[model samples]
Target: MQIQDLPYPDPGVPDVRSGPRFLWWLGRNQLGGQLTSLAWGLLHFMAVSAQPFCVGFAIEAVIDRSGARLALAGGLMALFGAATALGDTFLHRTAVTNWITAAARVQQLLARKASQLGSALSRRVAAGEVVAVSTGDVEKIGWFVEGVSRFSAAALTVVFVCVGLVVYQPALGIVVALGVPVVAFAALPLLPRATRRADVQREKAGRATELASDTVAGLRVLRGIGGEELFLDRYRRASQEVRQAAVSSARMWSLISAIQVLLPGLLLIAVVFYGVHLAREGRISVGELVTVYSSVMVLMYPLRHFEEIAMAYSFSRPSAKRAARVLSLERATDAAGSRAADLPSGDLYDPATGLLAPAARLTAVVCGDPDAAGRLAERLGGHPSEDGPSVLLGGVPLDELPLEGARTAVLVQDKDPVLLSGSLRDLLDVPASGEVGPTEALAAAQCADVLDALVQGSLDAGSPMDAHITERGRSLSGGQRQRLALARSLFTDPEVLVLDEPTSAVDSHTEARIAEGLREIRTGRTTILFTSSPLLLDRADRVVLVHDGVAVAVGVHRELLHTEPRYRAVVTRETEEETARGGVLKELHALGDAERLGDNERQEIEESA
Candidate 1:
């Protein structure tokens, strides 16, 4: 494939059984590119080998005092020079194209896997490992692939050169051929040691990278807690470990490089010494001696390729293993189950927990165990999580429907929703068929204060959606980020909206407004909220109390508070079952005024704003 035609239409499924197997699979996929590179490489090396032969012939012709032979040799030499130039240029072009194409294909496969696995990807592989594989590992893999053709051609060129020397003078040729192999394979013994060092270096580097990533992500929190120096020290130790490992690996490789250079240099001396001794004995012509010497010197170029190929394999082998591991990650799913028809329009019922939210009704679920409440939220949204019978939507098993189909109808917002870094418009972009305008959705989620804060210091008034939010909304207050997540989720306008403690970060005033806004916007759709707040719970059409893995009671907030002790205990974390935020909204204006008065603490100013 051409370099311009990168990202192959289909980067066929990788053979992930082993690193070597995966490497083989990569080579097999780009057979056309590999062959094209190979052909050009062979031509280049052939021309390189012919150069020594031509030089030798020209020397002999000059000695014979034959004008015709000199003219012929000069013409052949010129032709070889032209061939060498063309071969060298095209060989480099093809090798680079192969490298780019191969790297592009692997990148595409990785990107596809990342999208398919989503958040689960981090659970399977470390973030640093993924980064290493995509960057350094991919480059190493491509380096190996790009070098294969050149290595093969160089090896073949060495063989042809040896054969030509042998044909010219048998005695010297035999010694030259035998000594070439010795120089070529001398570094083999050091390779194993070098490869081991490389592996250690890679592992240490990966740990260091992971440490740095984690440290950067939590830098703000660390500084707040006065523990920044602690993490900095840890990172320094990790960095030193990586440095030591790298130095150790470099020492072994340096030894191998020295041997590669030393062996060839000694062999060249032997060829020259043996050729001189034979010339004095009249065993071979002086011209023949020169020819044999030139041939062996040329053979050094190919021998170096042998060393390069060894290093390439040593590095790419482990890289291939890492890449294969990432490609092998498959999401927990059933093919046959996913082929079933989509859920039509009806209630969401979880048979495993016996919790049901009727169609077009706002149902609030309160479970004492937060873990159980989280899992229940997953079920309500038809997330094919681990264990239990499938949750049904519109009389169809949720797990049986395609993932995309299930997500289309049910939208779940976890308590800790992530606000991705981008402009406000980009943050709200998601996969949903229903069209809810940004203004309408923001109004429903009571996010007016957030917009005001975002546009506070900015000049752009024409569109607040264009305003930038820092990575994970680090620049924004926690409460403001939470409101933004809720607004983005509300904009999806799905058939069912499942929210888990979505307004926990907001103040009572904003929470009350959100409660009313949510009820009004979700007037004709199913909304399942897994919360324990009495204010939010009081607004639900029906509150389901999940106790000990079962739905124990279903009723209004006040009715259940008076009727069921367990329901009251679950909803109210306090044993007394008091509304902690009761009458809190009466001080809404006061709270805002206090924050406005203390400009220094503006960072903690708003939950909704």
Candidate 2:
């Protein structure tokens, strides 16, 4: 397919069982592009081979002083040169198109999988590994794909030249043809070593990349905890390991390259020597001998195709494997059947945790282990459950519902939410049947400061809503980004809102305001909150204490605090911080208004918030 055709109308289901199979699938899809590239490549190589034959004929004609023959030979040479130029130009264009199209297809596949996986994406794959797969891995796969036609044409050219030489001078031709295989196979033994090293380098590089991404993502936290140097040192060591592996890989490839060059040069020398012997014996005409020698020399250039194809496969194999792994990741389940077309309205129930959010009520879930809380929150949102009871909405299996349908019925804002790079308005853009406007969602999420910070960060802007946000809102402060993420989720206004520690990064005062706003905004809607914050818990219609991985207690927030020791312990700790937070928050307000807080200054309040 051509670039003009653009993102494939349908990327089609991929054959992701194995790397080579995936590569074969890509080639199959781009057959038109590959065939066109192959045809052009053949013409280019044919013209290249014709040049040596023309030169041999021209030399013979000059010796005979045949004017007509000389003229014809010179004309043929010019014609071939023109044909070579045309063929080379088109060959490059078609090859490039094939590369771009193939990469685009892989990109589409990755994107589709990523969207299907949603919040579970980071859980399945490292952020760095995903980045590497999408960027470097994709490019390598494309490079190999584009090289396929060129390599095929080159190999065919070598065969054709060898056959022509055999017809022109059989004895010398046989030797040259046999030597071609020796030159091509000489590097085979070294390839295994080189490929292994390459795999090592790629693995090390992926780790380093993942480490760097984690370091950058948590730079704010590291600085807060005075662990910048610690992380920096770790990254330095990782990067050194990556560098060392790369050097080892390069050394092996260099050896292979040396062998490739050395063996081909020896073949050239052997052919020339043998041709001279033939000339002396008068076994072949001088013209034919010249043609044979030149053909072998030309053959050397095309024979390198074998070496190139091997190297391309070596590098691309791992890349395709990574891409395949990404593509093959099945969503929690095949998009459950029978989507809730018009937002299924009912109580949200999790049979595994035995946690239930009655319709039109705000239920708080308190988990001692935050990790457990996150998992439970995901399950509440109908994120794949391979075994055990499925989350049910309106008595239907939430896991059995289509992805879009489940998303419409229940929306979960994770503990750590990301804001994609775009304008403020664009960031909040979501499919919500709710009547809540941007202003309402922003107010409910307590995002006034977030809007102010984004407005100041934007280059060209009107209202704060029109301001642009950087990728993942990195330019924004922790609290600002958190509030913005909340605002985006609130705007969606789904039937059931599952918020896992949504206000963990904001201050106590801000969190209080958010709790108040959320209660008002979500009136008569099922809202499931997973957090340990007392201020948020105080507002829940009912609270469920999750201890040792199961729901052990369910009651009002105050009753649980007065009764359950485990619940009281977690809640009281936040209570102490909340008291101190009041004074600090007042001082913060005295310095300036909330609007004065830039996105960068909004620190994450604390971990256990």
Candidate 3:
């Protein structure tokens, strides 16, 4: 496909059997573009090859003192020169297009795989590896793809030139023809070494990239904990390893390059020496001798493509293998293990946790451990854990439903939801049911202040909705970002919404309002909330106390608070801390009041104090 028609309507299913197989699949998909590039490449190389022949003709005409032949020779030279220019220009343009298009196609496939895998992708693949594949590896792969056609064209031109020389003058032609292959294949022995070194470099580079990514992602936390230097030192070591690997790889390629240069020069020397001998013996004319020399000189340019092909393959093979490895990953049941099932309308039940939230009701789960809460929330949304039967909706396993069907039926918002960079309006725009509007969702999630902040941050914006958000909503406070994310999820209006600590970042006043709004908005839908906040639990229709990993008790918030000591301790820790702080403040105030009192009055109240 052409660049203009890029971002393929469907990137098509990738064949991830191996690196070579994946490369072949990419080539097969873009046969049209490859062929077009090949045609232009052939034209360019052929025109260039004809220049030596034309020069030979002009030399012959000059020697014969023939005006007609001279004029004809000059005309042919001019014609071929123009053809050469035209072909070279178009060939470059087509080659670049092929490169970009192939990269775009691979990017599309990676993106599609990421979407299909969802949160599972991050679990299966390293963030740095994905970043490396998407950024550098993609270009390397595209480079090899574009090089193929050019190399083919160059090889073909060498073949045609060899035949022409042999037909014109066999004595000199045979020597040059035999010498060309030597120059072309002389570097083969070093290619395997170069390729192995390149693989080492790529692997080291990928690890360095991963280290850098991890360091940057947690830079804030590292600084807070005074560990920034520790991470920096670690990253420095990784960077050094990468540099060493790269140098080793470069050395091998340099050796290959030397071979390419050395063999061609030796071939040129051999041809010149043999051609002069043939001319002295009167076996060939002076013009034919010049033709032979010039032909060898022109052949040098095309022969360089051989080395380029080797270098390109060496670099791209590892990149393709990494890409293929990532693409080959599949969710536990997303492969052929599961069949599409109809979306079910019933209670959401996690067999692992033995937690069931009945349909059309707001159920709250009180889990003291945040990690366990997160896992349960994921399960409720049909994302299975490593060692558990998939969550079931009604009686059918959620994993059995088609991916899109499951997503439409259940939405899970983890504690830390990401806010992608975009305008406020675009941020809220998602593939969602039309039941809820952005305004209603924002209001329900208590994001009025967030909207005001957005508008105030960008005064020239058309409206508050037009204000742009920074990546991950870094411009907003933790609570503000959480509310906006909640608003977005609320706008989706899924049939069953599973939230983990949705209001944890906000103050109790805001959290209380959000809990009320949440209950109101999800009047007839199934909503499961995993939190220990009394403000939210008090608003649930029913509360489930999950004590280790399983639901231990089921009751209303107040009932659990009085009857379940474990539940009360888990939910009342913040309240107890606040009460203790209040007591300390009261005693401090009493001491200050007594200090202000007269000595006699202080002594009268001293015993009570």
- Estimate TM-scores for all models: 0.85, 0.91, 0.85
For model 1, residues 406-495, the per-residue Cα lDDT tens digits are 677778887767788778889888875466778878998888888877777456645789877778887777678888998888888898
TM-score, structure 2 vs. true? 0.91
Pairs in clash, predicted candidate 1: 449-609, 450-609
Per lDDT, the best of the predicted structures is 3
Root-mean-square deviation of candidate 3: 8.2
Worst 10 residues of 3 by lDDT: 577-586
In model 1, where do residues sit more than 4 Å from their true spots? 334-343, 349-357, 365-391, 398-400, 414-420, 457-461, 530-535, 542-609
Model 2 pairs in collision: 477-599
Q: What tens-digit string does per-residue lDDT give for candidate 3 at 1-609?
A: 777887799988888999989988888888888899899999999999998898899999999999999999999989989988998998999899989998999999999888777766775699999999999999999999988999999999999999999998898889988989988998898888889999999998999899998887666668779999999899899899989999998988888888888888888888889888888999888999899899989999999999998999999999999999999986555433265655688998888878989999999999988887876777777667666898888877877878888888999887878889989988988988899888899999999999889988887789888998988887787799899999999999998999889888899899999999999998899999988888999999999999899899999999988667678778987455544444444564667873566767644444343
lDDT of all predictions: 0.82, 0.85, 0.87
Which regions of candidate 2 deviate over 4 angstroms? 336-342, 458-460, 573-609
